[model samples]
Every structure is written in structure tokens, then in C-alpha cells.
Target: MTQQPAADPFPPPSAPPAQQFAVPPPSPSGRWQPERVDPLPGTEFGLVQLRVMPITSGLAIGSLIAGIGSILVSFLVLCFGITGADSGWGGWVSGAFTLLSVVFGAGAVVLGLVARRQIRRSGHTGQVRFTGGGMAISGLVCGCAGAGIALLSLALALVLQVSS
Candidate 1:
């Protein structure tokens, strides 16, 4: 009889071999050709957008800082003068600071209003409006507070003078 070769247990599938893919020839510059990439749906790509800072931003910040500085100086002078720690110089220093505070406060208020007007005219693009508007409003509030404190101090000084 015979030991016939064992019948192949599992036959291979009869699928066709995969075809080879074709690649484009390299360019004269020896670089691979650039391929176009599709952006994700509902997204934008390409040129970068630039925005201009609002004109009033500088003015507002300047006024706010000046107002705050004036307030601090005036407060220190008032305190030192009252406690007799500053002698006569305190009065002069306080007067100077009070004047500065009032000037800065008025500047801040004016700049804030101008900034608002500019924003309205510019038609709201990017973050310019937000930043400029916020700075302007904050400056206005800070300046008003500083001016009020200075004015109060001035009144108090006048009263003290009258009483003395």
C-alpha cells in the first residue's frame, strides 16, 4: 500500500496579489513634490491675521499709573504730616501730589472717553476693542478715585488751617 503524502490540511485562499503602487519622479531640485493637505472641516488655514493696538491704550495706561502713583504719594504725605513725622515738608509734598492726582484723573477720564469713541468708529475687529475698552474704563475709574481722595485731603487741610 503506500504512505501517500498527507493531504494538505488547509488550502491557501485564492486572492490575487496586491499590485505595486507608483510614485512620482523626484523634481529637478532633488526634493519630493509637495502634496496638498486638506484642512479639517470648518477650519481656516493660511495667512496670519494681524491686529492694530488701539490708540488710546497708551494714554489710558499712562493715566492709570500716574493716578495710582499720585494717590499713594498723597496718602503718605497726609499720614506723615498728621503724625508729625514729615515736618513742614509734608504739606508741600501733599500739595504737589494732590495736584498731580487731579491732573491725572482728568486726563484718564478724557482719554477713556476718546478711546470709547475710537472703538465705536473702528467697527470692532479682533481684540483691539476689548483691550482698549477695558484699559480705558479701568483708567477712568482709578483716576476718579484718586482725584476724589486728593480733593478730600485738600478739604481736610483747609479745615485744619481754619481751626488752627
Candidate 2:
């Protein structure tokens, strides 16, 4: 005798399927493309928005460079003077380094002050604000310190020279 097929427990629905989110097809190069998604209500996404960065003042950067150079050269002057090396150019080299340190220190102070003023003015004008206020202040401090060191070193050298 032939057996009859078992009755189906679950049958396909007659109604059409619900609508789904549309997705773009892959590119011809077989790379997956990113889908554009709308941000949720009342939410802001930085990636979808243009951002502006504040500009750094050039004078502030220059001040920082000069200040660091002054400090470094001041140390070299101190080392050369303290070592008491009797090389032919020892005194001249030390004097030159000391002079360079003072010059760099002066430049740093001037540039830092100018940069600070420019940054303040720009901030008050409601335009793009300039950054690096801290750098300018630091440069000023470093420049003053370097200049003081050079002056002290020169005084010591002079006193020692006179005593001998």
C-alpha cells in the first residue's frame, strides 16, 4: 500500500513581507561601501559636521624657539667659563656664547609680548581665536631666566679675571 505524505504543521503566509531598510550594493571593485545613516533625533554627530580649529600664533612659536635657544646657549656659556680651559679662543668663545644667549633671550621676550598682545586683540574681536597663550608666557619666563644667567656668568668671569 502507498503511504500518504505527512500534513504540513507550518505553512507559508499568504500576505506580502514587510518593507525593509534599503541597502546599496557593493562596488564593482568588490569593496563594501559605507551606508549613510541619519542621526537620531535630537542628536548631533561630529563626523557629519564641519569643524574649525583655532590658529596658533606664529610669534608665540618663535618666542618659544628663541627662549629655548637662549637657555641652551646660556648653559654652554656657563660650562665653557666654569671649566677654565686655557685654549686660545676660550675667553672669546665664552663671550660670544654669552652674547648670543642674551640676544636670543631679548628676542624671545619681544616676540612673546607681541604674541600675547595679538592673541588678546584677536580674542576680543570675536574672530578666530589665537592659541598658545601658555607658550608665550613660558617663553617670557625662560627668556628672563636665560638672560639673568648670562649676565651673572659674565659678572663672575670679569671678577675672576680681575682678581687674577
Candidate of highest TM-score: 2
Clashing pairs in 2: none
The list of candidate 1 runs beyond 4 A from truth reads: 1-56, 84-92, 124-130
Per-residue alpha-carbon lDDT of model 1 for 1-164, expressed as tens digits? 88889888898646432221122335586533423233333333322233434455565566567656656655754664454322434455566667877887787777777766665666354444434677767767877887888777766654554454
Q: Name the regions of candidate 2 deviating beyond 4 angstroms.
A: 1-52, 85-90, 124-126
* Model 2 C-alpha lDDT per residue in residues 30-98, reported as the tens digit of each score: 543433433434333212221234689999999999999899998887777666544434456678888
What are the TM-scores, per candidate, against the unseen true structure? 0.52, 0.62
Total clashes for model 2: 0
